[model samples]
Target chain A: GIQVEQSPPDLILQEGANSTLRCNFSDSVNNLQWFHQNPWGQLINLFYIPSGTKQNGRLSATTVATERYSLLYISSSQTTDSGVYFCAAADTGANSKLTFGKGITLSVRP
Target chain B: SQTIHQWPATLVQPVGSPLSLECTVEGTSNPNLYWYRQAAGRGLQLLFYSVGIGQISSEVPQNLSASRPQDRQFILSSKKLLLSDSGFYLCAWTQYGRGRTNEKLFFGSGTQLSVL
Candidate 1:
């Protein structure tokens, strides 16, 4: 089983601010994803970057598989972005399955 | 477009009571289905996942169990609930045939269960 660690367990930002959330995995992964759990408890997929970088609107993510790390970047943050940001990864094993990090709680103040 | 439906939205059950939560996916066939639990202030934990009907993989040992009786339907059940069972339960699905490393996971609205 792979261990996923997220940094800065909590974060507070002002509207329009930018922030970077990092996720580090203990082993090589075959899949990596970032999700945003809204206030309504819906997990919204943000990025499915196993490697390289991807951008979706004001949110972007980069996964360095070799480095066993990934980052989620939020630019011009809005109040709607306030929620829990989670990063999950599946190791390159026969029984690989996604293991999630504890998650980063982000609060964007209006 | 694939969509997942999980219900009921919220529930409050007494300890030792029976529990059953249903999840169905539409617009897809042979899709991989999963059940995840998220405790308060914690990340999602994989409880069970199914690649096909009647096939399930349990991630963590607990009082809960899951079943995939249909191609797109998943059920989470518990014969006797415990106070520790209180949490937010989520059902998710992904593209079929990618069991080695599942594709982009899509989650349902989630169900909040409280065991008193």
Candidate 2:
């Protein structure tokens, strides 16, 4: 089993501020994904970056597979971004069962 | 397009009561289904996953159990519930892909369970 750890268990920022959330895995992974759980308990897929970089609107993510680390970047954060962000990964040897990290609670104040 | 459905949106039950949560996926065939629990302010924990009908694998040994009665249906059940069972339950599905690269998971709306 692989262990995933997220940094800054909790975070708060101004509406127009920028932030970076990091995730580190203990072992190599074949699948890596980022999800945002909103206040209403909706799990929204933010990114599925096993490697390289991907940008969606004001949110971007980069996964350095070789380094066993990934980063989620939020730019000009909006109040709507307030929620818990989770990082999940699955090892290549398994049947693709995801193991999740505790997550980073982000609050963007308006 | 594939969609997953879970109900009821919220439930409250006394300790020792029976529990059942249902999840169904549409627009896909032979997809991998999963049940996960998220405690307050915590990460999602994988409870059970099924690759096909009648095939289930439990990730964590608990009082909870899951079953796949149909290709697109998954059910989570508990004969007796405990206060510790209170949490948000989510259902998700994914199509298997070649090698290790695959598409992202599609999650259901989620169910909030509270055991008194």
Candidate 3:
């Protein structure tokens, strides 16, 4: 089993602001992902980066597997981006299940 | 593209009542399927996972069970639901891979179940 910790626990931002949420894992992970749980409870997948950097629109993620840390960056935040951001990881190889962090609740005020 | 469908989206059940949540995947075969429960203000807890048809594994022990009767379907069941069973249940799937991510998971909208 792996331990995951998320920072800030809570965050508040104004529209057009930028924020960074971090995830730290205790062990080496083969699978790493970032998800946005909307106000309606939809766990929308954002990124899958066990290592390296990837960008998707206003959202981007970077994982340094060696350091066992991943970061999710939200740029030009909008009201629609307000939700719970989660980081999850799988310590084993393919087909393994994920262990998720508690999550960071982001609130973007218009 | 692959998608997962979970229902009834929301449910309210009396304590000790039977529970059954179904998750089905489309446009994919032999994908690794998983069931997770997210408690209020908490993290996602892995409930069950299946690598293939009829091959199920449980991550935690409580009052629930999972079955994979079809290649693209996974079901979570409980004969007697407990108050603690109330939460948001999610179902997801991913392809088999050998890389850092292996394959990214696609999740369903999720089910909000409240046991009274």
Candidate 4:
């Protein structure tokens, strides 16, 4: 089993501000992803970057596999972006089950 | 397009009652299915996973169980629900790969369960 830790357990930002969320894993992983859990409890996939960098609209993620860390960046934050962001990883040797971090709760104000 | 469906978006049941949640996937074959539970304001916990039909693996020892009776259908069941069973249950599926490199899960909307 792999352990995941997220930094800045809580974050607050004003509209148009930018924030970065980090995820650290206890071991190497073959898959890494960033997810946004909306207020309605729907988990939306943001990025599937086991390594390298990827961007989707105002969201982008980068995973450094060797260092066992990943980062999620939200730029020009909007009210709709207010939610819990989670990072999950799957170790190759494991049973292909995702180990999720506690999540970073984000709040955006108008 | 691939899509995952889960039923009874919300449920409320009395303690000790039997529980069953169903999840199905479309547009794919021989997909790997998973069941997860999330407590209020907590991270997701892996409950069970199935690599193929009739093959199930439990990640945690709990009151719940899971079965894959068909290729695209996975079911989570419990003989008797406990108060601790109250949580948001999510069903997800992904294509099988040689290793984790090809592992990427797509989750359903999830079911919120409340046990009294």
Candidate 5:
């Protein structure tokens, strides 16, 4: 089993600020993704980046597979961004199963 | 576009009661279905996964069990619920891929289960 750890377990930022969340995995991954769990307990997929970089609106993600780490960046954060951000990974031989990190709680104040 | 439906939105049951939560996916075929649980102030944990109909895999040993009777339908069941079973249960689906590759996981609204 692979281990996924997320840093800065708790984060508070004022609106219009920027933040970065990191996820480190213990083994090589074939799949990695970022998710946002809103206050209502809905999990939304943010990015599917096993490697390389991708930007979606004000959110972007980069995964360095060789380093076994990934980064999620939120730019000009808004009040709606207040929630838990999670990163999950599936090791190369794990098939489609993904092991999740503890998640980073982000509080964006308006 | 694919969509996942999980219900009921919230549930309350006494210990030793039976529990069943249903999840269905639409607009896709042969998709990978999964059940995940999130405890209070914790991350999501994979409970079960199904790659196809009648094919199921359990990630951890717990009081619950999962079944995939149909290609797009998944069900989580428990014969005798425990207080520890109380948590937020989420259902997700992803595009099926070969060779162990995986796509993004799209989740349902989730069910808040409270076992008293």
Candidate 6:
């Protein structure tokens, strides 16, 4: 089993601000993903970066598997970006099953 | 395109009542199905996962159990519900095959269960 830790348990930002959320895993992982749980309780897939970097509009994520850490960057944040950001990872084991971090709550005020 | 369906949107039952939640995946065959629960103020926890028909693996020791009746259908059940079983239950699926990297998962809308 692997442990996942997320930093900045809570965050508050004004519209148009930027933020960076961090996730660290205890062991080597072959799968790492970032998710956004909206107010409606839907687990929205943000990024499925096992390694390297990926960008989707205003959000981007970088996973340094060698360093066992991943970062989620939110740029020009908007009110719609307010939600709980979660990072999950699956070890080098056979399955893509993942263990999740507690999450980082973001609140972007308009 | 693969999609997952979980229902009902919410449920309320007595502490000793039996419980059953259903999850079905469409547009895929032999996919990996999973059941996850998100407790209040906690992270998402993997309850059970099935790689194929009639196979299930539990992640944690709980009063709840899971079953894969079909290649794309997963069910979570409890003989007698407990107050602690109340939470947000989510169903997810991903591509499952030999040497295939199923990095991303598609999640269902989720069901909110409250055991009184």
Candidate 3 TM-score to native: 0.94
lDDT digits (tens) for residues B1-116 of candidate 6: 77889999999999999999999988888888889999987899989988788888888999999998878889999999999999999999877733344558778999999999
Q: List DockQ, one per candidate, in order.
A: 0.81, 0.62, 0.60, 0.62, 0.76, 0.66
State the lDDT at B1 in candidate 1.
Answer: 80
Cα lDDT of model 1 by residue, B2-103, tens digit: 888999999999999999999999998888888999999888889999888899999899999999888989999999999999999999998774464558
Interface RMSD of each: 1.3, 2.5, 3.2, 2.3, 1.9, 2.2
Name the regions of candidate 5 deviating beyond 4 angstroms: A94-96, B97-101
Clashing residue pairs in candidate 5 (N, C-alpha, C atoms within 3 angstroms): none
Off by over 4 Å in 2: B97-101
RMSD of 6: 1.4
Q: Candidate 3: global Cα-lDDT? A: 0.89
How high is each candidate's TM-score? 0.97, 0.95, 0.94, 0.96, 0.97, 0.96
Give the higher-lDDT candidate: 1 or 3.
1
lDDT of 5 by residue, A5-50 (tens): 9999999999999999999999999899999999999999999999
lDDT of 6 by residue, A1-110 (tens): 89999999999999999999999999998889999999899999999998999999999999999999999999999999999999999898866468899999999999
Candidate 6 residue spans exceeding 4 A from truth: B97-101
Q: How close is each model in CA RMSD to the real structure?
A: 1.0, 1.7, 2.0, 1.4, 1.3, 1.4
Residue B27, model 5: lDDT of: 92
Give native contacts recovered, as a fraction, per prediction: 0.91, 0.71, 0.71, 0.60, 0.97, 0.71
lDDT of 1 at A83: 92
Most DockQ-accurate candidate:
1
What lDDT tens digits, residue by residue, belong to model 2 across residues A1-100? Answer: 8999999999999999999999999888888999998889999999999999999999999999999999999999999999999999887774656789
Instruction: Give residue A19's error in model 1 in angstroms.
Output: 0.8
lDDT of 6 at B85: 98
